[model samples]
Target chain A: MSIEMTKAEVPGVPLLEVRDLHVEFHTRDGAAKAVNGVSYTVDAGETLAVLGESGSGKSVTAQTIMGILDTPPGKVTGGQVLFRGEDLLTMSEQERRRVRGDKIAMIFQDALSALNPVLSVGYQLGELFRVHRGMSRREARAKAVELMDRVRIPAAKERVNDYPHQFSGGMRQRIMIAMALALEPDVIIADEPTTALDVTVQAQVMDLLAELQRDFHMGLILITHDLGVVADVADKIAVMYAGRIVENAPVHELYKRPAHPYTRGLLDSIPRLDHKGKELYAIKGLPPSLTAIPSGCAFNPRCTQARDVCRSEIPPLLDVTEPDGTPIGGRTSACHFWKETIHG
Target chain B: MGRYVVRRLLQMIPVFIGATFIVFMMMYALPGDPVRALWGERAPDEAQMAALKADLGLDDPILLQYWHYLTGLLQGDFGTQISSRREVIDVIGDALPATIRLTVLAFTITVVVGIGLGLIAGLRAGGKTDGLILFVTLLLISVPVFVIGYLYQTYLGVKWDLIKPTVQDSEDWGQLLLPALVLASLSLAYVARLTRTSIVENRRADYMRTAKAKGLSARRAVTVHLLRNSLIPVVTFLGVDLGNLATGAIVTEGIFNIHGIGNTVFHALNSREGSTVVGIVTFIILVYLVVTLIVDLLYAVLDPRIRYA
Candidate 1:
C-alpha cells in the first residue's frame, strides 16, 4: 500500500534519520544482536512513535540514539544514526556527548529511579542551565523554577528544593520532562516515558510532550509499547518486531489500516474502552531470543498469517499500495499476507 | 542525634568489658610469667618471687585481677609498670599524641590522595591510568607492612633523602614519615581500589545517565553524582579498618624509631611491664571506638539512606 501522506513534506531537512542500524552485545554465552538493521527518519517538528513490545529493541535503540548504551554489554555494530546530517555512529565520544544534551536529549522511563534521590528537583533541573549555558546558581535556580512552572508542577518555586523522593511518580516524570526541556535541544527521545506512571499522569505527560514539541518544533521520538499513546501524538509510527523495523507509515494511515502483521497484532491487542468486556486479543508466543534469532522472519513463528515463504526467506519491506497507489513513509511493510489483515 | 550519642555511649559498656576480659585472658595465658621475666633467667628464691607476685596481686584469682584492672581503669589510676615504675596512664598519654599525629596525617593523606586518584581513574575506567592505579594498589596491598616500612626507610628515607633520617631513639618527623607512609600504604591502596570500584559503579548508575541527560559535564557527573554516593561504602571500609590500622601500626612504630603506643607496648612486653601493656591496649580500644563512632556519623551524612537508629 504505497499511500504516502501528502503531509510528508517536512520543512527544510529531516532532523534525524536512522539507516540500517545494528547493535550487538558480547556476553559470556555469546553475541546478542539487540537491534538489527532498523531504519527510520524524523523530520523537524515531527513525532515518530517507535511502537514495539517489550524486548523488541525499542529501549536499546533509544539508548543507542541517545549515546548512552552500556559499552561492555552494548556495541553499535553497524549503523548510521544521522542527527541533522551528522553521522552519530561515526562521531567521537566527546563529539557525541556534546550533541547528547545540547542538540539531542533523552527522557528515561521510571522517573522515580531516574532522578538522583539525594538531589533536590531544583538542583537536577538547574544542572542543565548551569552546565551547557554556564548560568549562575541564582539564575539557574530561577530558571529551574520557571521550568517547573512550565511543566505545571504545583508550588514550583516552593517545591523546587524538594528531593526526588519527595515528589510523586507523576511529578517526578514531569520533572524529568522539565529537565529534558531545560536545554531546549533540537531532538528529544523519550523512551517509555510514561510506563511507570498512572494512566492519568501518562496522558498529562504525553500531552505536555505534544505541547512542548509543538512549541519547540523539535523532532520528538516517542518509544512506547502503548498504542493509545501513539494514536494521539505520533505523526508517524514505526512498528518494530524482533529488533527490526517491520513497518513504517503515518499514524492516521497505519491506525486506519495497519500494513504489517505485527502492527495489526499490536492494534488488536489493545483493550479498547469502546469494546469493554470483550475478549482481549493478544499476540501469541514470546519475543525471539536475540542470541539465537529465527532462520527467516523473526516474527514468522508468532505471526498468524505467516506463510511457508515467511518461514524460509525474510520478506523485505515492499511498498504496499492502495488502488490509487500513493507512497507512505516512502515504505510500508515486510509481510507476504499484509493485505489480508489490512483489507480484512 | 543526642539520643543516638547517649545510646551509643551506653552500648559501649558491655563491649569495653568484653574487650577488657579478652585482653586480660590473653595476657595471662601467654607462655611466660611476668614475675619470672622481671626476676631474670636465674630462678629467684621464694622470698623475691613471692614479693613480686604479691606486688602484682598474683595471689588473686583471674576474675579478681580483671575486676581490679577495670576499676583502676575507671578511676584513671592504671598502675605503674612493674619494671620501669612509669605509670601506665602517663606512658600511654605521652605516646597517644604521637600515634594520633601519625595516624591522622596518614589518614588525611590517604583520603585526599587515594580518593582523588581513584576518582580520576574511575571517571576514565578501563583506561591506562585506571589500569596503572589498579596495578599499583594491588602491589601495595600484596606487600607486607614491615617490608614497605623498612623499604621506605632504606630508600626514600636514607638513600634518596626524600625525607631525612633520625637516630633510632629520636622522636622526630624524619623517622615518623617512613612509619606513617608504611602504615598508610595498604589502606591508601585499598581505599583507592574501593573508591574506584564504587565510583565506577555509581558512574554507571541510572541516575548518572539522568545527570548527563540534564547536560551535566562529565566532571560534574562523576564528582557531584558519583563520588558522594560511592563514598558511602568507603566510609564503612574506613570504619572497619580503624581496628586493623591500630594493630598494624605496632609493626610500623617498631620498624621506625617513633616512640608511639605501639613501641611502648612492645617495650612493656619485653620488660614484663603488664600495666603499660594493658594501658596501651585500652588506649587502642578507645581510639578504635571513637573512630568507628565518627565513621558511623559520617555514614549518616554521606548516604542519606542511612539513619542513626
Candidate 2:
C-alpha cells in the first residue's frame, strides 16, 4: 500500500546526474543541435533551476531525461542519465518505464492539456495507483481523494468526480503536481510548471512545490526562463543559450555576480518598481537559429564584450574566478572574458 | 437532464409536423391522380369519381386536407392502403421488424469492422498496413451502394455460395448476413476513415503523452487514452449513419427481395399509394429524430463537458 520507494541511501551518490548529453533535431533544412554537451547534477533535497529563454533547449533536456522526446524529428545522439548510480539511457524501455513514475516523475506546464479532458481528475489520479501498484478501485479512489486534499484542493470529495475543465487552471495544475507526487519518486522534474499561471497563483504553486520537495527530501529540477521565479527557491542555477549552458553557479553567487554576458543581460532586463519611469533594459538581438548557430560563441553577436578570441574559438565551460584569481567552487562559465564580466 | 430531455421532445413537435407536411405536399403535387389510379384500367363514372373524391376528403382545400391528415395521425390512424385496403399501421407494423433486423445487423457490422480496421490502421499509421486499409476503404467509398449489393449477391452469394442468396420470410440469421454486409460496406468505409483520422489526431494530443508518462505501456496508453477520445467523433457519425442506413435499406431490400419498410415505401411510391407513402415517410422521420436525440444524449454521457443544461 505504501507507494514510497527506498531513498537515495548512499550518501555519495547523486540523485540524478547528466553527463555530456547531446541531442539534435533532424529536419529537411538541417540538423538542429538542441542540447549540446549539457551536464548537471541534482542531489537529494536539492533544487536545481535550469533557466533559459524560448528555444534555448532547457525543456528539450528535461524531455530527453524523461525519454519523452518525439523521435524521427528529435534524437538523443549521446548522453548518460545516471539516477542513483544506474545509467537510464542504456536501460531497456520496460525498465525505464518502471523507473519513470516510480523513480522520477514529471509535471508538465499546460495542466489543462496534460490532464485528460474526458476523464475525471480522481480517475486520472487513481490510474497511477491502479496501474503501478495494482490497487483496488476503491483504494485508488481513496488515495485520489487523499492526494487532492494534500494538494489543498477545496471540496476534494465533491470535486473528485469533476472533469479537467470543471476545475480552475490553478486547481488543475495542483492536480498535476499531486499525480507526480502520488508515487513519491526520488526526483521530480517540473518543466515550466508555473509559467502558465497568474503571478499570485504562480507563487502559491511554487511555494507548495518547494514545501513538498523539502518535506519529502526529493530532488526537484525546476525548468523555467524567468530568473525571478527561481530566485527564492533554487539552490543552484544553470543559464542556457542557443543549446548550451553558458553559465552555472550557486543561486546567490549568480545573482551577486553573473559570469556570462547573457546572464548579466537577463538579470538587467527584469523590470524594477524603483525605476518605474526609466526605460527597462532589454537584451540586444535575438537568439541565433539552432540549425545555423554561430561558430565561435553563439551569443557573441548579441554580446557586448565580443573580442577577437571570442569570435574565432568556441569556449569550454571553464572555472570562474574572483578578481583575486581565487576559483569559485561549482561555478563555471562558457564566456572567454568571464573575469571581466564578473569584475564589472 | 430530465428537463433537457423534455425540452428536446417538445422541440421535435414542429419538426415532425414540418416533415410530414413536406411529404404530404409532394404527394399532392404528383402527376397522376390517386383517384384514377384507384380505378385502375376502367374509367369511373363522373358521379362515382366525385363521390370517391369527397369520401377521401380529396375535394377539400389542400390546407384542410393536411389538417385532417394531421388529426388522423394524432388519433393513431395512418389511413388505409389504396391497393390492399389494409390499415397503413398494420402494413408498416408487419414490415417494421424486417427493416429493423437488417438495419441493426448492418450497423453492428459497420461499427465492429470500421473501428477494428481504424485502430489497426492508426496504430500503424503511414505503414503498409495503414495504406492497405485506407485503399480498401477508399474502394468501398467510391463504389455505389447498389453496385456493392449486386456484386456481393453475385459473387459471395450466388457464385461462392457463402450464404443464402436471398433474405427469407422466416427469421434466419444466415439469410440476412449477405444483405447486411452489402448494406454496411459504404458506411463501414466512412466510419473507418473517420476513426483513423480521429485516432491519428488524438495520438498527438498532450494527454496521450501524459498517459505514457504515467508509466503506461505504449499499447495500453493508445487504447485507454487515445481510443476513448478518438471515438467521440465516430459515435456522432454512427448516430446519423444509423438513420441513413434505415432509409437506405429500401434499395438493398429491393435488390435482395426482402420485405422491409424500404421495399414497402418503394412499392407505394411507384403505385401512387399516397397514404402508405406518407405514413412510411413520417415514420422514418420520427425514427431519425429519435435516433438523433439519443445521439445527443450520448454525447453528454461520453463527454462530461457537454452538459445538457
- Candidate whose DockQ is highest: 2
Clashes by residue pair, model 1: A1-A320, A1-A321, A2-A320, A2-A321, A2-A326, A3-A326, A4-A326, A4-A327, A4-A328
The number of the candidate with the highest lDDT is 2
**Pick by TM-score: which candidate is best?**
2
Q: Score the docking of each candidate (DockQ).
A: 0.44, 0.77
Which runs of model 2 end up more than 4 angstroms from their true locations? Answer: A1-8, B42-47
Clashes per candidate (backbone, < 3 Å): 9, 0
Which pairs clash in model 2? none
Q: List model 1 lDDT by residue over A120-193, tens digit each.
A: 88888887777778899999999999999999999998999888877889989999898888878888999999
Candidate 2, residues B1-309, lDDT tens digits: the string is 999999999999999999999999999898887777777889868798889889888889999989998999999999888668899999999999988989989999999999999988987889999999999999999999899998888888899988677887626767888888888999999999999999999998999878877888998888778888999999999999999898789999999999999999999998888889999999999999999999999988788888887
Over A1-344, each residue of candidate 2 has an lDDT whose tens digit, in order, gives 11124342657878899989999999887999999999999988999999999999999999888888888689999979988877888888888888887779999999999999999999999999998999998999999999999999999999999999998889999999999999998899999999999999999999999999999899999999988889999999999998899999999999999999999999999999998999999998999988999989999999999998888899999999878888898899999998889997
CA deviation > 4 Å runs, candidate 1: A1-10, A20-22, A26-32, A43-45, A72-79, A85-95, A215-217, A272-280, A311-313, A324-331, B31-38, B41-64, B116-143, B147-174
Q: What is the TM-score of chain B in candidate 2?
A: 0.96
lDDT of 1: 0.82
Which lDDT tens digits does candidate 1 get at residues B1-309?
778988988888898889878877878777777777766778678898888789779879999988999899899888877766668788888887778777776777678878887887887899999999999999999998888877877888789988755436344655565667778899989899999989878887899878766656677777798778888888898887867777887888787767787788888777666677777887788878887888888887775556676
Q: On a 0 to 100 scale, what is the lDDT of residue A184 in model 1?
A: 82
